[model samples]
Target: MDSLYLLLPVSVLLVLALIGVFAWAVNAGQFDDLDREGWRVLEGGEEAPTATKAQQAGVPLDPGQL
Candidate 1:
């Protein structure tokens, strides 16, 4: 029963820390493009707008590369 007193506060602090990290990520735009990478992989190595990231990074994508 005494352990519960410590465990409850620790668990609550863990939950709050996780929530803070998630909030920081959201504010930092980490979740802004969740499906973008999935679509890029699904689109395959074939050339397409999948190179948008590379293009934005000023790196050119070859005609046959993802």
Candidate 2:
């Protein structure tokens, strides 16, 4: 019962803190370019040019394999 009191307040505070930070980020236009980021991933625009070249060259990379 004593631990419940401590844990509840801590959990509520953590959730409220996350909500506050998310609200601040939304107010600061952090979500403005959300669609562009997702679209870039689908369009493969986020890939490195050198990686594409290496793929075309048939030269296998060690850790940067496409």
Candidate 3:
């Protein structure tokens, strides 16, 4: 019973803190354009990774290249 007094307040405070953080994130544009980054990776741009470049160039790739 005594533990409930401490735990309940702590849990409530923790939930409130989490809600505050989420609200702040929404106001700060953190959630904006969430899909743009996902699309960017799928849509492969001009800049390629080293492994991809070596494959394109037909050069053997070392472990570092990967």
Candidate 4:
């Protein structure tokens, strides 16, 4: 059928476009840190290294209070 001639080329073009996008993603480092994120979740995630008592109290730390 004549429709097949149109549909076939359109389908091929779509497949090629998808492949191009996937290749671009690979070259752009989209998949580079795949495992690090998974491992990070298992590591209990990051937390600030320290917080002062005044910070927790929502008050500016006054040296006199210490």
Among these predictions, the greatest TM-score belongs to: 3
Backbone clash count for every predicted candidate, in the order shown: 0, 0, 0, 0
- Return the clash pairs for model 3, or none: none
Candidates in descending TM-score order: 3, 4, 1, 2
Q: Considering only N, C-alpha and C atoms within 3 Å, which residue pairs clash in candidate 2?
A: none
Tens digit of lDDT per residue, candidate 1, span 1-66? 999999999999999999999999999999999999999988788645554676889987787884
Candidate 1 TM-score to native: 0.61
Query: What TM-score quantifies how close candidate 2 is to the native fold?
Result: 0.54
In Å, residue 48's CA in model 1 sits off its true spot by 13
For model 4, residues 9-65, the per-residue Cα lDDT tens digits are: 999999999999999999999998889988877988477677777698898877887
Would you give me the overall lDDT of model 4? Answer: 0.90
In order, the Cα lDDT scores of the candidates are 0.90, 0.86, 0.90, 0.90
| Model 3: ten consecutive residues of lowest lDDT | 47-56
Report the lDDT of model 2 for residue 48.
Answer: 65
Measured against the true structure, the TM-scores of the candidates, in listed sequence, are: 0.61, 0.54, 0.68, 0.61
Q: Which of the two candidates, 3 or 4, achieves a greater TM-score against the reference?
A: 3
RMSD of each predicted structure: 9.8, 5.2, 4.4, 8.2
Residues 25-63, candidate 3: write the lDDT tens digits: 999999988999999889997866565665888988788
Candidate 2 accuracy as lDDT: 0.86
